[model samples]
Every structure is written in structure tokens, then in C-alpha cells.
Target: MKPGSLSHGSSTAWGKALRRPAALQPHLPHVRTPPTPRRAHCPPIRCGQVPKTPFEGFVARPPNSELHLGNAWSLAHACELSYLTQDEVRSIAEGRWGLKGLLCYGYGDNDGPDTQCFAAAGPDFIVVAFRGTTSITDWVRDLKVWKLPDGPLGCEAHAGFLEGVQGKWKGRSIIDSVLQGVRDLERQYGKEEGLAIYVTGHSLGGALATLAAAYMLEDPELRDKVAGHYTFGSPRVAGPRFKKRFEALAPAGRALAHRFQNREDVVSKVPAWWRAYDHVGRWWYLAGDDQVLMRNPDLWTRLRDIIDIDWDFQPDFVYDHQLRAEGTGGYIDGIEKNIVRSA
Candidate 1:
């Protein structure tokens, strides 16, 4: 089967399978159902590490002209590039991605690096990509589900994600460095030339990207410069308050932020609703069989989908979170396929 293809009748079967057992059926009013599953106890899954040469043997495809698919493919590649070493990233930025004046940050932090991001400029745009979980420390951070009450926009957010965005290196926070890079790019190319800013990442990096974009949007000078923020397999990073603030800050009629959730990508479901965490921005659900839902499915639909997941497949959670180049059931693969279909 293709990366995003589902077997026939799977959805209907899953929905039917979720019917309450006889013991817990409505007729048995005296019977109590089992407690809901606690996802907190589940061990953290490792985010995939792409091959050292991520772009090797792969040609950059012209993106479909549609806004979402075009930006999705480009931002997905930017996220893939985040995993490379600085030199390799720089070389590829200029050669493959056609980027100029690259600014790489968060490398060589032996003391303990909390985040990594890079800003690369093209003739008409700039992309800020955040690196996803790549170390034991990253996994540890991912497990830190605690919320900080005083996060960005004066709303609550995942403590670890907030730290990743606000943590300082050499007296400068990650967002600060990223903004400085953006400013430099605007000056070099002339903001009059309409240099749009795009922020993106996968998994843990996606959380940081969302937070970073939120911070940028709050800034008067940078707010209008932001074109869009895209994330893949990103877990919930903020609470309802933050979501409200983000929606207010986002431009009217323009979907400035989008979260792409691949089929059964467990990372996107984390810091569960029970923890008061909520996702920000429009959701794009990549249902198997080349179907993409622009909005989140209803609760019952989501529940049924969860019940239908193939848990028998070992490492299913991690497998769905991968960002492989293409044809490997990864985010990039899914987005590229969507791009082809849209074309």
C-alpha cells in the first residue's frame, strides 16, 4: 500500500468495533466501564533521524501552485534539512534549496543544547526551520509535560517547549537569534522587495516553530513579515488561552498557521487534552488514500480512527512520525505525494 493509503472498509470497521461491550452497554446501568487510558505512562517514542545525506539522489520537485501544498512541500524539506550538520546544511541551502546568506544556530552546545534552528534566505522568502528530537536530552524534554502559567501571550504552554523557545545561548534566546537572522535577510534583500518569512519543523521542533512564530507575530515590526507557520507531527504545545491569543494575532482570512497530522502520527496527539494542552492553528489531516481534510475531524471520528490504529505494528507511533525524503511513509513523502495529486 502507498504511504497514505488505507485498506478498504477500514474506517467503517473501526467505527463498528468501537461499540461499547455488552458489560458496559447502556442497558446495564449498574456496570461501570474501565478507566480511560492514561497516556502519560506510555514511554516516549524516538523521533526518526534521517540519513546523513538526506537530499542525496533526490531532485527538488516544482511545488504545486496551490498555496497549502506548495508551502507544505517547501517547509517539509526545510524541516528535513534541519537534521544535517551545519556545513552540510549550508551547502544544501545554497545548492539545492537556492537559499542565500544562511544563519545556522544551536550547534556545538556541549553544556546542554535545548534547541536548534536555522534561517536561510531565498530571493523572495526566508525559511526558519527547527530541528526535531535528535538526542536523549530531546526525548527527556519531550516528556516534560508540565505547563508554565506565564508563557507567551500571557497564556500557558508546555514548559519544555517554552524553554526551548526562550532558552538563551551566549546571552541570546533562540527566537532572538532567529529574529536577528530575519532582520539581516530583510536588510540584505530589502524588505521593500516583500521578503516573506516562513517558519516550520517536525515533531518537537514543530512545537518550537509554533511558539517562535507566535512570538514573532506579537512583534509589531515582524508581525506583517510572517507569511506562514507550518508544523508536522507536532504535539499540543499550549492551552486554550494561547490558542485564542494566536487566533487573534493571525491575519484575517489568511490561514497563517497550519499543522499537518499524518495518519496515526502519535506525536501530534501528545500532552493530551487531559493535560489542558491544545493545538493552535488550522489542522490538515492527512488521511490515508491521498485524502487530506482541511479541518479536524469530529470527536467521534477521531475516537474511531484511534480505535482503528494498527497497534500490532511494532513502533507504529515512531514510524508514523518519520520525515523521510520520499516514498517511505514519512511526512515529506506524504506531503510530496499530496503535491503530485494536487498538480
Candidate 2:
């Protein structure tokens, strides 16, 4: 399958599967039910990091309100956005899908630049999604969070992430692109009908999305228009100072800012608590029913369930990062089951 193809069993599959679920699965329920078992004759699943088979049943545990199904779908959408190419983005724009593509901006001018993201508008919401680092060099960028750049935004952020978000793409600032996407949506959809703006991504993309949402919230008008900021497998993006700033800017209920942590995902724990970096806003934990080993975590608690660094070095680290297979576990599986039932 190509970069943007809707290959079965990947994020793209979820994107196509969910395109019109509004018509089919009117409400993505948060119930638990077993998935269909695979036939004995089927080949042994090839994917080892995460289970390829969907989980038997799913029961969501949102820290605050009932699991926000809309937030779950947005996460799936944001994940899919990371897979799209410029051409495929155009195809989605011209198609009948509920999501209309707007921008696919990236400064791939050099070998490995830490700047790339996209934006889009639906009837009632606008989405700004950042693509996680795709190259080894980009991964190097992920590690360089040592210095705080001088700026009016005194709150210190993950140094690399701050630079990535502030960098220019195609002669225009990436932040400006996101803001412009929202403004264009407002022009087309009108800000009045309770239109929402969602900033989301997975992994590094999630970090950038968090930064974008924080900046948006600083503007009183934008804060009211935003419905939620959702991220999957996102790392710590700021220190306590910025955390306090984010809380004051958006608060918990003002606009939902949720970090969906997959069970044992080692990435979410990085820029570690020991390093004094803190996760902002609410944490909605997603793990298998059997893996319900963790209760809600406190600010200083090192994620109790994360695969420990001292443990055996292996693929389990990578497996924990995968979006739970269709029914295996995590937020997407719940939405997948609901879609199947609706169909």
C-alpha cells in the first residue's frame, strides 16, 4: 500500500471506516462487548508489537465526564491525517467524506526538518493536525529540548517542540497556518452555530497539537470556539510554569484538553517527571480490560504501568505505542466496535 492508501488494518482503515459513521453509528457507545474470534485456519497474525485482532470487549474510563466519543473519533482522524499525502489530501477534499481537507504544509526542503502539519474543516469543526517525526534525524530533534528560546510567551515549552511549532513552512509560519485554517473555517462555517475547533495528533504530532491548542486558548475568542484538544501517545510538552499557564488559559471544562495514554506506552512518559517536565490537562487512560492495572495518576507519579527502562530491552516498547488493533484495546477499538455494530 502507498503512503495515503486506506490499507486494511492501519490508521487509514479507521479513517475510511469512520468517514460517515455519523450516519451509521449515530452514537459511539462506551460499552464492553466481545469481538468476533478469528478462524483457526487464518494465518498467524504478523503484527507483533500490538495485537492485530480487535479486543473481545471495551469499557471506556474517562477521568471526568462520560468518555467523549467525539474526542475518540477526532483522535482517529488526527492519526489518519499523519498518513495523508498532499494528493490524497486533495482527494479527501473533493470526496463525500465529512472531513474536508484544507492544508498539507511541510518544509521538506532539507533532509530532516522538524516542521510539518496539516489542517481541515468539517461542517461543525476545524481540525489542525501535526505529523509525528518520520525520520531518524527528526527523532534527533525530539531529543533536543534543553534550551528555552527568548519570546513574549514566557512559559517554557519542550525546546524542540517549541522550535518545531514556531518554525516556518513554505515561507509561512506553521502557527499562522493553523490559525488561518481556523479563520477560513469560521468564514465558511460561521463561528456562531457552536462550531468547534479540535487540535490533535499522535506522538510528536500530539506534542505540537498541544502547543497549538495552548496558543489558541490564549485568545479569548478562539478559546470559546474550540471544542477540545485531543492527543494520543503524546509526550510531556511543558514544565509546571507552562502547565499552570495552560490551566488558566483553557482550564479542564472550558474546552476539553485530553491526553489519551495507551497502556505501557513508554513515549508518553518521556521528558520524564524526573526531568521536571509535566503533562498538562486531563489524562484519559486507554488500556486492555485486563490491563486495567492503573488507577488515575497524580502529578508526580511516574506512570506506574509504563514498561520500565530497567526491564528487558525488546519490542514490547514499540508494541505499546501502536494504536490498539480494531478490537484489542485503546480508544479507537471502542469506536470500531460501535461502527461494526451499527453496520
Candidate 3:
């Protein structure tokens, strides 16, 4: 056959193939639900060490939020780049954060930090913070005080959050925990030059992740220390002013590593658009903020239920992933590397 003739035939074939039936088309791999006999736990979560999956050098524990593949991938990347190294990073456990709620991402818990699952190393962090939350510290000797769920990624809350919350829907325990975690990191790896203070979380935990970053940015000293953040399915926390406010105080490049997901994802849609705190002015000062369409995250995945029962459920994590990969997470990490690479 002539070269031009062959080319023409290929083009024609491509066009014809485009008309194939929808069922006959190929689709991207999808995450299937756990089999009928799911993890016996109420809201199943998996926590464990990802030692072989490209994260050999780091130690990790799944925060019981949701041990998602994407979150795990991002966690490995962050640790490798020195953006967020696993250490004696500490976190407080919530009353099994995700399993009992529908809006698991909502900030609605607090109580004298009931337990300290010090990761001398363990899965005490929000294995999920909802994706297998882990720590970088081992100061404590035993896990006796730990209240880990059945899965490896179980997490009630991390150490840095605000105290005396729960009822107020104002969570800062996660905040304080992070601050302390940073101090711990400084104590342990301070001599390790080029070290960065980074925070990451997926879904409900993403909200906490942002909250933690915000607190760190509030302090010039702390902000300068942190390198960046990587979040997946993070909801819209605060408003436009948050970016500016954090930048002014921290000076350090702020990055929100964000990734969105389609199914069983309620985090991105949390802090519902209708919340008064959606704006910067409110979020920074308001006491108790509520929103329309908000549901109890204690029972199930709100967004997923909505999609599965109320609307067409063809959701995509691509947009959420793009928002972070190309925007904040990637851009800020680049800047940090340029500046802190040799520091």
C-alpha cells in the first residue's frame, strides 16, 4: 500500500471507532468497594507501613480516614522530596473520626486530647487523618493509651488540633498537635539540614490539614520552618483572604497539595458552600459556623450517598488532583526547593 493511502485508512478507522457503543468503550480503572464481608469494623479503615511502595525510606501509619491509593502516592512523594518527612509527628485520635459520620470532614470534636498514640511508631495518627494518619516520633514507650480502630489508618485526631472543641464545632486540637509535632521534629531532626515541616491529608483530614497549615502560617517562626502541604479531597476551607493572610504572616511559600476524588468522597464538598465561614472574614473570627446541605459525617460518606442515591454518580478526582498538582502543591514545593534545598 502507498504511504499516503495507509495514512488515510488509519484516520478513517479512527473516526469509525469513535462511533462504537458506550458499553464497548474502554474505561479507566475504578476503585471497587470492599467485598461483601468488608472489614468487620463499623467504618473500615486500613493502616500499615507502605515500606515497599516507593516509600521505603519513610515510616507511615494510615490515619483511619481512608487509606486511599492517591493519598498514599502523594504521601510518598512528599516524604521523598523532603517536603514532609515522617518522624515522631504526633496526633490525637478522634472517637474513630470517619466510621460514625456522614460529614466526617466537619470539625466537630474535642475533649482533653483523650489519647496519645505516640508513633514511637504506630498507626495512631488519622490513618485516614482519614487516609492512614501516621507520626514521626517515638518519645513515648507504649501504645497502651492508643485507641486505634480495626484498620491501620484509624485516627481520631492528631496532636496539633485546638483544645475544648467538639460541641463548638471549633477544632484546634489538630492545630496544637501539629505545632507540637513540629517542635518534636525540630528536636529530633533539626540538625538534618534541608528538613521541611509539611502536612498532608486527604478528604476530611484535608480540612484539618489546612487548619494545621493555617496555624503554622500564623506564626512567622513556625511558618518559615514548614516547607509545604499536600492535601487530597480538601474542601474549600476559609476564603480568598486566607491565602493572602497566610502569605503575609508566614513569608514561606504556602502550598496546598490537593487531590479530588469522585466516589465515596465527601471531603471536597464539605464546609458546604453555604457556610458563613466560607468567607475569610468569618472563618478567621467566627465562633460557630453552620451551613446548608451539611450532614452528620458520623454515619456515612455524604457526597457519595448523594451521588449514589440522588444524582448521576459519574464523578472525577481529576479536577481535585489538578488543583493541587499544578497549582499550590507543585508551585509552592518548587519555590521551597529552590530556597530550602541547601538550607
TM-score of 1: 0.76
TM-score of 3: 0.38
* Stronger candidate by TM-score (2 vs 3): 2
Q: Report the number of clashing residue pairs per model.
A: 3, 5, 77
lDDT of 1 by residue, 2-94 (tens): 111222333442222212111121221111122232121211111133323322222211121113555566678788777767777788888
**Candidate number of the best lDDT:** 1
Q: Which ten residues in a row have the lowest lDDT in candidate 1?
A: 38-47
| Model 1 misplacement above 4 A | 1-67, 110-112, 191-193, 289-294, 298-312, 325-328
Q: Please give the CA lDDT of all the candidate structures.
A: 0.66, 0.56, 0.31
Q: Order candidates by TM-score, high to low.
A: 1, 2, 3
| Every model: Cα RMSD to truth | 13.0, 11.0, 20.6
lDDT of 2 at 284: 56
lDDT, candidate 2, 142-246, per-residue tens: 898675744214677777887777777666677876777777767776645655677777777788888888878766657767666778778988788777777
Q: By lDDT, rank the candidates, best first.
A: 1, 2, 3
Task: Please write out the lDDT profile of model 3 over residues 231-315, one tens digit for every residue.
Answer: 5445555544454454444333322232323223333554455542231111100000011111123233333333332122223
